[model samples]
Each structure stands twice: as structure tokens, then as C-alpha cells.
Target: MDAIVLLRDGLAAALTPGNLLWAFCGVLLGTAVGVLPGMGSAMAVALLLPVTFQMDPTSAFILFAGVYYGGMFGGATTSILLNTPGQASSIATTYEGHRMALGGRAPQALGTAVIGSFVASIIGTLVVALFAPTMVDFALKFGPGEYFALTVFSFVAVAAVVSGSVLRGVASLLIGLAIGLVGIDGQSGAPRFDFGSPVLLDGIDIVIVTVGLLALGEVLHVAARGRNAPDLASIRAGKPWLKRRDVRRSLPAWLRGTALGTAFGPIPGSGAEIPTFLSLGAERRLAKRREQRGGGESEFGKGAIEGVAGPEAANNGSAAGSLVPLLGLGLPTSATAAIMLAAFQQYGLQPGPVLFERNGDLVWTLLASLLIGSVLLLVINLPFAPLWARLLKLPKPYLYAGITLFSVLAVYAINASVVHLVMLIGVALLAFVMRHFGVPVAPALIGVVLGPIAESELRRALAASAGDLSILVDSGISLTLYALVLIAAFIPLVSRVRRLRAERRERETTGAGTS
Candidate 1:
């Protein structure tokens, strides 16, 4: 009953005239950012962080939540229409969504993505409302050693699961760890990687690294590749309209995707990518099984509606899922969530065990606002699909130039330091190299955000135990987390070995037949 009253109060706060206007503006801005290639909610939220300093924390957070949901929806628009995902989460959407566009069923693809996202978003929001406090309670039981173990689990899971090559992901994460080593040492007040430079003592700002790597790096890479005309002319249909068949196929897939997303959301190091890919793989297998049984034909590769529907739903669902850790444990699983963490720090807020007790109104109001934002996204996205497609019509040179310009400007505006500008360019170059070599970028961002936390916890645990390393593995939670890390790490290697063996057998069989 008390929970019900708090929820009602939160809803009332979110629906106020001023708050509603902020939600609308945030949705608009976030959608626009999502429609642009390589621009993401992280950048949007980071940019707004300095700007929203004077506003009420609740209102600023409401705006950020709106942007977060809007960006998820908007990225789907670009994926369906142009075969180009505006954000990493939308990558799976492009596999079949673009094919649907090419087949003159762009409207159908768009409809599935939007509707699936809406359903998943609502379900995810309800999850946050019901489980956040419980999660906070659970988090309070963790010690420094448990926290250290959790970070290891996160590192292994994220690196092994996210990248196509585990070695590359580990390499990227190392780079981030190395970056994290810069600045003054937490315990000794000694600088490790500053190289005698004053600017290095403060450490590289995460905002600079994020914008440089994601936003600027993408632009530089694109410019280097030279522009090609995006083939969006034939895909432009009116508003997204769902057919009966489309509804029949997408409904179950939506539910399955939502389940996968919700399950993975709070796990450290697991983000939207894993859930989206898993949903797509599941849907593909289901379609194949249906074909074998003669119940339906499988469209596994050539414009399957279920492919678009399931992954898009998972993407949005995971977005909501990431919040579970962010709000409940002060752990961020993805790049955008990392930026949100920074925002929390900026507002003098910490998002952990005491957040609910200390800031109940803010926390509940934020949850209510997320629910409100999801509805607003549905209303706003449906009508704007066509207009967003028009964004692709803009000249490539001007668009990329503008993105690069704004990225540099934003970094400079943050600290007014020439050193940051220099660091931004350097990081952009490093990101370009990583992109060229097919390195997954998220683990790097994750490492940068989580590395220091892990370091701090490790040191604390050692100090508490008189430098005994055994304490790091003493607790049940720590042991379980380490065991899970071993499982997460071993599964990928085992799967890879099995796949290679299977492929070798198939090749031998084919060679024998040819001979």
C-alpha cells in the first residue's frame, strides 16, 4: 500500500506542466541524436550534463530518461530505413530490417520495431518499479572483496561475450585499464602515467574519451573511407502500418526478446548486444524448426520480420535492464549508463543502497518518468519515421563535418582546456585504429568506467585483511561470482573449439565427395 502511494506521488510529479515540457523536449532532442550515425544517448546525456547543472535534479533526470528511451527508438528508424544503425544496439536490427526495406516492406519493418520497443519498454519499466528497492537491499550486503570479484566477472563476461574475437576485446579493455592508470594514485597520491605533465595528473576525462572514441572516431573513419550515397530512395513509405500477418509473427518474438533482455540487464558486464544477438539466434532457430515441420517457410536471411522484431525489442528491453544495476548498485554496464553515472556524481547523488532511503522521491519519480517517456516515444516515433528518413538526404560532407565540429566544441566547452582538445584528437585516432581492426569498443568504455572502482575495492579488501589475498575469495558471493566468471570465460572458448571441429568435419566430407 505504501508502494502504491509512492508510485502515485511519482506519477503526479512527472505529470506536472513543467516536467512534461522537459520530457517532450528531451524526446525530441534524443530522437534527433539517435537518427544520426554514431551519435548516441551517451553523447546526448554528456552534452546535457553541463547544461542542466542549474535545474532541479528530478527534472534533469526525467529529461535524461526520455532521451535514453527516445534514442533506442530512433536508432531503429535509421536501421530499418538505411541499413545503418545509429547506435551499436541497433546493429542486429539492420540484418533483416534493411532487407525488409529493400523488399519494399519498410513500413512493416518499422512497425515491428516501434511496437516491439514499446511493449518491451513498458515491461522493462514495470520491472524497474518493482525490483529496484529489492536490488538495493541485496547490494548492501556486498563487501569490498565481493565488489572486486564482481568487477572481474564483468570484465571476463563483457570481453568474452561482446567481441567477435576475445583477444581483441581483452586488448581493448587493457587499453582502457592503461588509460585508467593515469592521474594521481588514489592511495599514495602518486601519479603513474602522467609522464611529468600537469594535465595528465587529473587523468583523462571519461566524457572526452567517450565523445572522442564514439562520435569523433566514427566521423574520422567515415571521412577517410570517402562518402558513398546512402541508398534510401526506394525505402521511403508513409507512416508505419502493421498488417495482420506482421502482428501474428512479431508478438511472440517480442515476448521472447523481452524475456532475454530482462534476464541479462542487471548482470554485470552483460549489455544489450548479448541479448539482441541471442534473441535473433533464437528466432532464427524457431523459424527453421517451423520450416522443417512444414508449418511455415523460414525467411532466415531474406527479410524475416521476426528478425527485426525480436532484436529491436531486445535492444530496448536491455536499455531498461541496464538501469537495474545503475539505479540499484551504482554499477554501469554500458557506455550510456556510464555517462548517466557521471551525471549522478555531478548532481551530488550516489545511486546505491542509500539512494532510495535518501532520495525516495527522486528515485520513484525517475521510474514514473521512464514509464511516461516510453509512452511518449511510441506517440512521437510513429509520426516522425518519415521525417527521420529525410535526415539521410542531407549532404554527407556537411553532416560529418558538423558532427566532428560539434564533438570538438563540446569537449572544449566542458573544461576550456587545450590539453583536452589534444587528448580528444589523440583518442579519436586510437579509436580509428581500433575500428579499423574490428575491435569492439564497449569493453574499453566499460573498463574505463569500472577499472578504478575495481582497483579501489581490491586495495580496500587487501588493507582490511592485512594484505592477505585470500580475503578476495573468502565470501560466498565472491566465490560464486568468480565461479561464474570462469564459466563465462570458458563457454566461449569451448564453443569456438566445437564450432571449428564441426567446420573441419564438414570440409573433409565436402573434399571427399569432390575427389
Candidate 2:
């Protein structure tokens, strides 16, 4: 009931002429940013932070949200047409979407993607709206042990699952932890890694690390690899409307994607891209069973409709799912989510516990706006998806140059520090090295961002308990959390051993039968 009242009031505010205009403009700008490759919402938002200083916080936030969602929406275009995901999240879409384009069904492919995303976004928004407050209460009671356990769990799950390799993920996380350690020690009042620089005493800024690793690193990586081809064209289908059967086949897939996304959305350290792939894999397994039973043949690699539908649904739903932790526990799992958390901080807003009581209006308003945005995406995109794609056709020199300039300006504006600019360049070089070694970047990032906070909690808990480690065992919840972490850490190796044993047995059985 309280949520309902809040929602009603929020809807009224968001729908006002001024706010609506802001929303539209945000969506447009966000879409444009999305059309450009490697230009993620975090980069877009970070770059715009300077201009935002003078703007109303509400309107600026609305624009940021629009850019965030719009970038996501635009990412699919390149994936569907060119098999190049504009951002990381659209990677799965390209698997089947590119095939659809080759088959001259680009229009349908685009339609399904847009529609699926819109639906999922709405579901995600609702999940945020309904569960955030309750979850915050649950998170607030957590002690240091629990926090540490959760942090470890996040590192393992995201690193092992999100990154290509568990070893590399752990390595990257450790690096982040090291970087995180480079500030004044909260407990001893002594600098650990400042190296006598006064600027280092306060610790590295999250904004600095985020922009350096994500934006500037991306630019440097592309530049180092030789100039990217200019004037690449995207799929230019005539329309973006789906066929009748698309709706029938996709509805089920969307539901499945939504389920997967919602289940994983609340978990920390997860990103939007993984859910899409997971959904695609789930659909394939299910589709294989249906084909086997019904005498249907596989159409998986050939633009199977289910491939498009399931991933699309999961991606959108997970986007919605992501809001759960952000709004509830104040944990920003993805890079984009992290930036959003930063935005909240800039406004002096904390996401957990009292957010509902203090900023219920803003929360509800955002939620209501999400519902509207989803609908608008459906209507706007189904017809205009190509116009969005045409952005890729623009001259390459201008595009890349613009992106580079924006990257520089955005970073410079954040601090106006030449030292930070050099730092950004150095990080970009490191990112390039990591890429070459196939090390996942996100874990390193998650580590750097979460390390300090996790350390703080651990130290606080230890001090509170007079350095007695037994307090880690005091709470049932904390004990359970640690247990889960232990299991997660070892589960992969256990599974692999079991799998290899089973395979060996199968081979032995086949040989015996031949004899």
C-alpha cells in the first residue's frame, strides 16, 4: 500500500511535461551513445557528470537512466546486423541475430530484441520496486564476517562465471585488492601505499579507477591494435517489425529469460551480459529435448527463433533483475550499476535502509518512469531500429575521434588533475595487457571497488571483537555465509573431477561392450 501510494505520486511527477521532455531527450542521447561501439553507459554518464553539476539532480538522473537503458537498447543493433556487440551485454544476441540478418529476417530479429528487452526492463523495474526495501533491512543487520563472506562469494561467482577462467579472475581480483590497499590504513592512521604523495592519502577515487580502466583503457586498446576500420555498415533491413510466429515462439522464451534474470538479479557481482548467454544455453537444452521428442530438427545456428527470443528476454529481465541488489542491499553488481551508485552518492543519497523513507518519492518516480520507458522503447524501436543502426554508417574518423575526445574531456572534468590523466593512460595499457592474456577485466574492477569497503568491515569487526576471530562464528547467518563461500570456492574443481571420472567410465564401458 505504501508502495502503491508512492508509485501513484511518482507517476504524476514523472509524467509532467518537463520531466517527460527530459526523459525523451535522455533516451535519444542514450541511444546515440549506445550506437557507438565501446561507449558504455558508465563512460557516457561519467563524461556527462561535469554538465550535471549545474542541472537539477532529478532531471540529470532521469537522463542518466535514459542513457543507460538506451545504450543497452542500441547495443543490440550492431550485434544483430554486424555480429559486433556495441557493448559487452549484446554478445549473446549476435550469436543468432547475425544469422537472422543473413537470412534476410533482420527486421524480425531487431523487433524481437527490442520487444523482449522492453518487457524484461518492466519486469526488472517491478522487482526493484517490490523487494528493495525488504532486502535492505535484511542486509543492514549483517556483520563483518557476513560482509567478507559475501564479498568472497561475489568474487568467486562473478570471476569464475563471468570471466573466461577462474584462475585469471582470482588473479585479477588480487590485483584490485592490492590497488585498493594503496591508501591510508583506516585502523592505524598510517599510509600503506601512498608513497609519500599527499594526493594519495585520501585513496584513489572510484571515478578515476572506473574511467581509467573502462573508458581510457578501451580507447588505448583499440588504438594499440592498429586503427579500427572506419565506415563500417550495419544491417539495414527495411522494417523492424516481427512476424506473427515470432510473437508465439518468443513469448515462452521471454518468460524463461525473465525467470532466469530475476533469480540471478539479486545476486551481487553479476552483470547483464551473462544472463543472456545463460538464457540462450537454457533454451538450447530445452529446445533439444523438444526436438528429440517431436521429431523436429535443430535450427539453432541458423537463426532459430527461440535463440533470439530467450536471450532477448533474459537480457531485458536481468537488466530489471539488476535493480534488486542496487535498490535493496545497495550493492552495485555491474559497472553501469556501480556508476549509478556513484550518481546516488553525488546526490548524497544512500541506496539501502533509509532510502525508501527518505527518498521514496524519487525511487517510486524512477520506477514509474521505467514502466513508461519500456513501453516507449517498444513503440519507438520497432519502427526506428534501423535509423538507430544507421549511426554505425557515419564516418569512422569522426566517430572514433569523438569518442576519444569525449573520453579525455570526461576524465579531465572529473578532477582536472594531470596526474590522474597519466594514471588513466597507464591503466589503459594494463588493460590491454590483461586482454591479451585473456584475463577478465570486470573481476579486477570489482575487486578494486569492493576491496576497501570489505577491508574496512573486516577490521571493524575484528576491533569490535578485540581481535578475537571467534566472533566470525557467533552468528548463524555469518556461519552459513562462510560455509557457502567455502563450497563455492571448491565446487568447480569437484565438478570437474566428477565429470572426468564419468567420462572415463563411459569410455571403459564402450570398450568392454566392443570386446
Candidate 3:
């Protein structure tokens, strides 16, 4: 009954003309950035953070909610049409989306992706609304040791699972930790890595680093690569239409993907990308099994509609799921969620159990806005698919030039400091180097965001136990978190071995055929 009242009030608040206008604009901006390669909702929110500092928190979050939904909607647009994933989560979609495009099923592919995202987003939002309170209760039980263990689990899971190589991921994480350490220590009065500069004493601003690494770094990298944009001239950009057969195949896949994605969302360090891959893998295996049983024709690689629907749903579902921890525990599990956490802090608000009690209106309003934005995204994205495709044809130099300029202005606007510009350049350069070396950047961003919390919690837990290290493992929650971390860390290794064995078997079979 309380949930129902809140939802009613939330709908009333969110439906105001001013808030609705903000939601529309946010989704529009999010879609624009989402259609562009290497730009995600994270960059959009980061750039808007400094600008929205003085704005009302509820309205600002409404704008952000629109952007979040729009990014998911528009990401699939580029993946299907240009074969270039606009964001990391869209990578799985590109595997089959582009092939479907190449096979002249672009309309069907686009239909599946957009509709699938809508279904998943709805399911995910409902899950959040229903389960967030429960998670808050769970979070209220966490001790310092448990929180510390959770952070460790996040660090290890991201490092081991996201990157192509665990070593590179750890290297990126260490870089973030180093960045996180530069500010003044909260427990002590002393600065750690200020290097005798007053400006450094405040530590690196999250806004500056976020904009520098994601926004500025992308601009510089694109410019450095020179004139090789993919051709979208041959791509179709029409409205997506689904036949009965297509719907039949897509519905089940969409549900399955939503389940997998939503389940992974609350787990620290596991993001949308993982669920999409898992969804795709499951769909592939299922399709193969169907074919083996002589049940029906399987389109495993050649424009499979299941491929487009399932992974896209998973991607959007996980995107929604990431909010669970952010709202309930004040923990961010993805780059976009991390930026949103920063936004919460910027507004002098902390998201957790207390947020619900003290700021119930804001929480419910934001949730209501997510649902509104999801609808807006579906409405806007469907008819605007052709327009979004045209976005890819915009001159790269101009597009990136605008991004570069905005990034500079946003960074300088934060503190109006020349030092920030310098820091932006330095961080952009570091990001470029990391990208060049195939290093994963998400873990670095996560580390920077979570590092301080982990450090403080570890210290507090140790202090409570008189500096005894065993206090780290005292809680049942901490032990479970640690165990999960080990499992997450080794899953990749086990998968790699299984893959190698499968390849060996394939080779043996091929050899026998030759004989």
C-alpha cells in the first residue's frame, strides 16, 4: 500500500510540465550521445554534473533517468546499423545485429532490439521498485568488514572478468587507486599525494577525471586516428516491423535475457556487458540444440532474430539492475552508475536506506521518471531510427570538435581553475595510452569511485579490532563476499581451459576427417 501511494505521488510529481520537458531533453541528448561511438550516458551525465550543481535534485535526477534509458535505446541503433557499438554494453548486440543488417533484415533487427529493450527496461524497473527496499534492509546489516569485503569483491570481479587479461585490469585499477589516494585523508589531517600544491590537497575532482578520461580521451583518440569513418550509406534506417513468427522467437529470448541481466545487476563489478554475452551464449546453445533435435531451422549466425532480441534485452536489463546497489547501498556497479553516485554526492544527498526515509519523494519521483523515460525512449527511438542513423553521417571532425570543446568548458567550469585543464590533458593522455595498450577503462573508473570508501572502511574495521587483520573475515557477510570474489576471479580461468579443450577436440575431429 505504501508502494502504491508512493508510485501515485511519484507519477504526479514526475508528470509536471517542467519535469516532463526536462525528461524529453535528457532523452534527446542521451540518444544523440548514444548514437556516437565511445560516448555513453556516463559522459553525458559527467558533463551535465557541474552544470546541474545548483538545480533541484529531483529535477536533475529526472533528467539523468531519461538519459540512462535513452542511452540504452540509442546504443542499439548504432550497433545494428553501423556495426559499431556506441557503448561497451552494445558490443554483444553488434555480433548479430550487424549481420542481420548485412543480410537485409535491418528493419526486423532494429524492431527486435528496440522492443526488446523496452520489455527489459519495464521488467527491470519493476524489479527495482519491488526489491530495492529489501536490498536496503540487507545493506543496513552490513558492518565495516562486510563493506570492505564487498569492495574487495568488486575490485577482484571487475579485474578478473571484464578485461581481456586480468593483469591489464589490475593495472588500470591500481592507476585509479593512485588517483583516488591523491586527495587529503579524511581520518587524518594530512594530505597524501598533494606534492606540495594547495590545489592537489583537495585531490582530483571526480568530474574532471571522468570528463578527461571518457569525454576528452575519446575526442583525442578519434582525432589521432584520422579519416576512416565507417560507411553508413548502405544501411537501412526504416521503422522496425515484426511478423508473428519474429515475435514468437523474440518474446522468449527477451524474457530469458531480462532474467539473466537483472539477476547480475546487484552483483558488484558485474555489468550489462557480462549478461549480454551470457544471453547470447545461451541463445546460441539453445538454437543449436533445437537444430540437432530436428525441431526447426536454426539461424545461429545468419541474421538470427533471437541474437538481436536476447542480448539487447539483457543489456538494458543489466543497465536497470545497476541502479539497485546505487539506490539501496550507495554502491555503484558501472561507469554510468558511478557518475550518478557523484551526482548524488554533489547534491549533498546520500543514497541509501536513509535516502528512502528522508527523501521518499525524490526516490519515488526518480523511479517514476525512469518508467516515463522508458516510454519516451520507445516513442522517440522508433520513429527516429532513420534520424539517428543520419547522426552517424555527421562529419567526425565537427562532432568530436564539439565534444572536445564541451569537455574543456565543463572541466574548467567545475572550479574555474587552469590546473583542471592541465589535469584534464594529463589524464586524457594517460587514458589514450591505456586505450592504445588494450587496457580496460571501466575498472579504473570504478576503482577511482570506490577506492576511498574501501580504504576508509578497511581502516575503520581494523581500528575497531585493535588493528587485528582477522577482523576482516569476522562477519558471515564478509566471508560470503570473499568467497564470491574467489569464484568470480577463477570463473574466467576455468572457462578459458574449457574453451581450449573444446578447440582441441574440434581439431582432433578435423584431423580424423582428413585421414
* Model 2 lDDT tens row, 190-264: 998888888778777655565555545655555666655222444455676666867877888888887777655
Predictions: Cα RMSD each: 5.3, 6.0, 6.0
Q: Compared with the true structure, what per-residue lDDT tens digits does model 1 show for residues 1-515?
A: 67667888999999999999888888878888886655668778988999999999999999999899888877777677755466767767876887888776777787788888889998887876777666545545678898788778767766775576889989998988888888999899988899889999999987687667666776677777763534445455666778788889999999999987876677665567667767876787689779879987898678999998899889888888888889878999787899999989999999986888899999889888887887888888777556655554567777667767767776787679999999999998998899889896767866776799899989999999999999998888889989988987887788779889999999999999999
Candidate 2 residue runs with Cα over 4 Å from true position: 1-16, 32-117, 127-133, 195-204, 211-366, 391-402, 473-487, 498-515
- Cα shift from native, residue 306, model 2 (Å): 9.3
TM-score of each: 0.74, 0.69, 0.69
With a 3 Å backbone cut-off (N, CA, C), the pairs that clash in candidate 3 are: none
Candidate 3's residue-wise lDDT over 319-373, tens digit each?
8888888988899978889999999999888988788899989999998888788
Give the C-alpha lDDT of model 3.
0.80
Instruction: Please give the lDDT score at residue 398 for candidate 2.
Output: 62
Off by over 4 Å in 1: 5-19, 32-68, 71-117, 227-366, 511-515
Rank by TM-score (best first): 1, 3, 2
Candidate 2 lDDT (Cα, whole model)?
Answer: 0.71
TM-score of model 3 (CA atoms): 0.69
lDDT values, one for every candidate? 0.80, 0.71, 0.80
lDDT at 167, model 2:
89
